[model samples]
Target chain A: MDVLVYIEHLNGKIADVSFELLGKGRELANALGGKLDAALIDANSDLATQLGSADHVVCAVDASFAQFSPMAYKNALAAMVKERAPRVVLIGNTSMGMDLAAGVSAATGIPLIAYANHIAVRDGAVVATAMVYGGKLFAEAEPEGEQVIISALAGSFSADAGKGEGAPIVEIFAAPTGGAGTQFKQLIQPEAADVDITKQDILVSVGRGIQNADNLEVVQELADALGGALSASRPVVDNGWLPKARQVGKSGVSVKPKLYFAVGISGAPEHIEGMKDAATIIAINSDPNAPIFEVADYGIAADLFDIVPALTERIKSG
Target chain B: MNVVVCMRQVPDLVEELEINDAGNDLNREYLKYVVNEFDEWALEQALLLKEAHGGTVTAIGLDLPEMDNALFTALAKGADAAKKIEGDFANGVSSHTAAKLFAGALQAMPYDLILTGVQSAEDLDGQVGVLLATYLGLPHVTVVTGVEVSGIQATVRKEYAGGMMSEFTVSLPAVLGIQAAKQAPRYAPVSKVRAMMKEKKIEGLSSSDGAASSGIKVRRMFKPEGGQRAEMIEGDADAIAERVVSILKERGLVK
Candidate 1:
């Protein structure tokens, strides 16, 4: 195998990032003139059938593999990498992927480049463009080894390209056993919905620049004036100022509102992943170089404290 | 129980970062350095564990500029001991190299749990804790939000994407990449920190020479190309607000 894409799944459903990797994996495999393989752990034939873009589907089936056991999954993936010796392994740069990528690389002694947003074959060597400094800079990097592991960031490729109908070879093998140092108890789902930000046509989103929980009223007034709900970035949610339902990001609700009025939000890629598809984005931040400006349709490089209240009053009067 | 928390300083993002002449790294001469935010949470988690389970918390960091002040601050904030791993970190070390150095320095220490930040601005790889765990032959967990210890077992709360979370019971002698603590990290008074600087000492540990390279070589570093940049609605705050209202009205977002 030339390119191996790790298929990530939850609740028996394959993750979209896995499909995105498969799309990129197919392209890289074709460039190398080799086969693209998808590695599925404890997944059913139904899931395997969905991985038609890959030339082959390698499944490691075991009872313990049903749920994500970090140690077990790490050992199994490392073993597969050793056995297959694929030139490049593509894993989604997601929460689960972050847990496994470095461990697998260390176990197999293969160099890993993470946070990759763009990858290509150059001079017969795989080079990747990785996001650094919270997406403020891009680092073009190449691994120095026969085999390399690249954890591509989510939203880097198109999921539609990886979806199609084609029969690929399927192989099943028993997973390695007996490294159970941790036990998964239960998954805590998000709190019951207070207000679904996804259903709203307009959203007033705030970030760390909101300053304090008490300061949320400034942005709340804007959202009320616009006849929309208030949402926020991860920091605001993590700070306990906003409920999880009102958060927008990869780990929060993805919102595609008609108007995304951002105040004080610096657009990290994870935060951008959720709201980038908004119809019209307007951002207000003091930092002129904030990444949020890159995605906003209109922006004001001014203090949110000064602009937000004024905007709220203007909209309210009209 | 004994705990070790690894921390590092990163270039403060508040200041604009400029690439060095090498085209592969940041220009560090005028950069302000601060403790990596997630690592502060890791230290807080360690302190919490120590306070609950009766153990000593050891704060360890690479020998970078202003690291001693961070260590003293940690000591003032409740850490029992501090150690700085001496190494050639002038240009900064990759996560791979830092993991190796940390592993080397930790080989002789007695630790029931090792904690580190899940990721940093420089190390978006999020590799150190996991790689360090691999080197130490210990089980590791990442993105952990909270940890509760009883006897030799710890029940940890790990966060997944999309507001999902899971509980895991991990055995002792494990490594955890802490995402957040139960509460915000406590602040150390400047006066107490000054007392720690005067009364306490940070032990120095030497890093092994010629630590193996991380293998991934940066060819170049550059700012991201602007993609459909937002049209600037400049001037004072009032003008900006008026323009925003007009845009919203034009788009029919508001009447």
Candidate 2:
């Protein structure tokens, strides 16, 4: 009943998603009456104290780890798993996590179930719940073998910083001594948008339903009337109707605006992953059953063609 | 350069889906299948690479009733050759099983690189490409947006979280999970697809080799609990606008 959680860090601080995994990992370990251990590729002092919930913190310090190299991370994690043979391993469902998990699972032949929302020990086996059919359905899965790895979907669990007063035992591990075929070059940050929608409290975000490029003017007019910034879904950015900077989705800027207006946006789970934290979300779509309505505060099931002009006029008159 | 892309036919999710009586899988009664979007990206990337660098692009998929459309579409979209493996994966096979089948069939062919979608919406598992790479003992990367191939080496742009990207140089005989193809998958007119169906032959491979157990099983599937339900505001266009304006005013989002 040993559990291991992989800790991800950026600029020496642990990513929030890693803390969420730690919280869930601690719960799973306690349920199975097992010890929880945290595995980190980089050595960061500030991160080690926050992992007090874990009985041991295994750190593999290497200069290569300053930037994420999937091969390097996979080599280190696979070695750690081989030594500890933890029953369950938890990783954050970030891009780096998915990349590393794929290689590790293949290299070790361990069972992996990604996009897990809930994990538990049932009947002496690790059971995890994951989404299928684009978040329309959920499946509960169990590993056929003794060992399993589960990637925690972001924002699924509450992150706990831990309550223990004493620092956890830290064990330093050696980096893998092999040629990493892939080299990590510089990380290219997206060019700054003329307007950083992340700083905007009110946003008028458009999606595929905007129909055509010419129709964007109406959405723009609405944004102007509402005193909000113009934003968009991935499709808009992909279609080159808007800058990539204004895109709101898993691959775009995560926004916490106060009032978010979703116009003609069908809520894909990837898009929802970014804007779900907004204070108030109002979604407008013709389809009543589009997933956007499920998370929106106000769901308007009407054509934007009919709704936009009237809404814009009202704000203008007032 | 020789490129291979693995495409999968999935239930078109735009249409309504119902739970089967077994309560563990989707009802196949009303489901219409189509090539997965991500795999379409993979196919397009392979074809684009073939166009840029002189190579033959081969597309493969498991045999299904809806598979012919996918294969012929690949041909119409400029795939040099198409293959359909004779297998009944209708009920749905694990990514591990599919990867093994692909790897087994690929062992006979000369290939410089392999590609597939990052994950399928149907299974939501992103392991097939990685498993295939592992089975073939090749270096691999996932969520690739761009790839520049040169002889035995490749430079790829891999997307990470928060819109950050990293450029990597990997040796050839590698696998990549295409997050987005360099170009949107070309739309072939149905007439072209029909013409290709009659003019070109799709090589069928029978792969009866048993795959190693996937070591994971689904216990059950159920609809997730509703997270938040929207407040329905039904009215005429003008009435709705008034309601929305008042709400916005209350929220202090308007001037």
Candidate 3:
């Protein structure tokens, strides 16, 4: 195998990021003139049926692989990498992927490039462009190794390119068991009955620049005037000013609202990943160089404190 | 339970970051350094664990600019000890090298749990904790939001995307990448930190080991290319608000 893409699945559904990797994996494999493979480690999920873009689907099915036990998955994936010795391995830059990627790299003694958004074959060597400094900058790196692992960020490639109609050769391998130090418990989903930001048409998002919890009233008033729900970045929710449901980011809800009104939010890449698809984005921040302006449809490089109230009043009077 | 918290200082993003003349790194000259935010949460988690379970919390980091102040603050916040890996790390080291260096330093220490930030701005690999665990031959979990200890096992809350969380029972002597603590990281009073600086000492560990030569090499560093940027709505707050309202109306978003 030349390119091996780890197929990440939860609750019998393959993650979109897995397909994205497979899409990019196919291209890299073609460039290397080798086969593209997918590693499916699940207890009972028939996820291999969906991995048609790959030439092979290596399945490691065991009862221990049911839930995401970090130790079990890491051991299994590491074993697969060592066995296959693929020149390039692609994993998603997600929570689960993060748990496994580095450990796999260490176990196999392969260099791991993370937060990679762009990967290409340059003179038979894999070059990757990775995000750093909260996505403020990009670093193009090339590892000097026969095999390299690259954990790609979500939405880096097109999912449609990964979806195809073909049957891949499936192979089953025994999953490593015992010496597992982690046991999975119940998954705690977000509480229901709160305003689902994903379903909202307009989302007024707040960030660290809101200053304090009491000041949330300003952004809340704006959300009310715009007939939208109040959302927040991770810091606001981390600070206990808002519920986790109201948070919008990589770990929060991905909202494609008609209008994403950002107040005092310096858009980090994770936050941008969630709301960049919003139809019309308007940002109010004092810092003109904030990354939020890059994605906003219209921006006010002024104090959000000043513009939020005036915008609320203007929308209310209208 | 004995806990070890790994901390790192990153270039403060609040200040303007300039690319170095080499075009492969940040210009450290005139750059402000601050503790990685997630690592602060990790330290807080370690402190909370120590407070609840009755153990010592040791803060460790690579020797970097202003790292002693951060260690002093940790001590003032109730850490039992502070250790720095002494070396010339002015330009910083790769996550791979740092993890190996940490593993080397930690081999002599006694710890039931090793906590570090899930990701940092400079960790291009963004897997220091995971790599560290692998190097130490320990089980690891990342993006953990909560941890509860009992006997030799720990039940932790690991967060996932879209506000989902899962509980895991991790065995002792494991590593965790703390995403957030139960509460915000507590602030240390300047006076307490000063007292710690006067009364306490940071132990130094020597390690001059370099990163693997075959590892990833940065070819260049550059700012993100600007896409279709937002149209600037100028004037006073009222005028900007009027323009916003007009855009809303134009898009049939408002009356």
Prediction RMSDs, each to the true structure: 1.4, 2.4, 1.5
Query: Cα deviation in Å at residue A23, candidate 1?
Result: 0.5
Model 3 chain B: worst 10 consecutive residues (lDDT sum): B208-217
True-contact fraction per candidate equals 0.76, 0.73, 0.85
Q: Docking quality tier of candidate 1?
A: medium
Better of 1 and 2 by lDDT: 1
Q: Give the alpha carbon lDDT tens digit for every residue of B111-195 in model 1.
A: 9999999888887444688888987888888988879888888888887776888788888889999888877789999999999
- Error (Å) of candidate 2 at residue B91 is 0.7
Lowest-sum lDDT 10-residue window in model 3 chain A: A173-182
DockQ score for model 3, please? 0.76
In the order shown, the candidates' DockQ scores are: 0.75, 0.63, 0.76
Model 2 lDDT per residue over A69-186, tens place: 7677778898998888888889887777877676677778887888787888887888999867766677788887889988868777887643345567998877583436677766
What does the lDDT come to for candidate 2?
A: 0.81
Which candidate order results from sorting by lDDT in descending order?
Answer: 3, 1, 2
Which predicted model would earn the best lDDT?
A: 3
lDDT tens digits by residue: candidate 1, A1-318: 389999998888899999999998988998888999999887355589899898899988876677776777888888898899999999987778987899888888889898888999998889999878777788999887667899887888999989867999998856686545877778889788788889999899999899889999999989999999999998787667888788898778788999998999988777888898999999988888888888899988888999999988898889
Q: After superposition, how far is residue B200 of candidate 3 from its true place, in Å?
A: 0.9
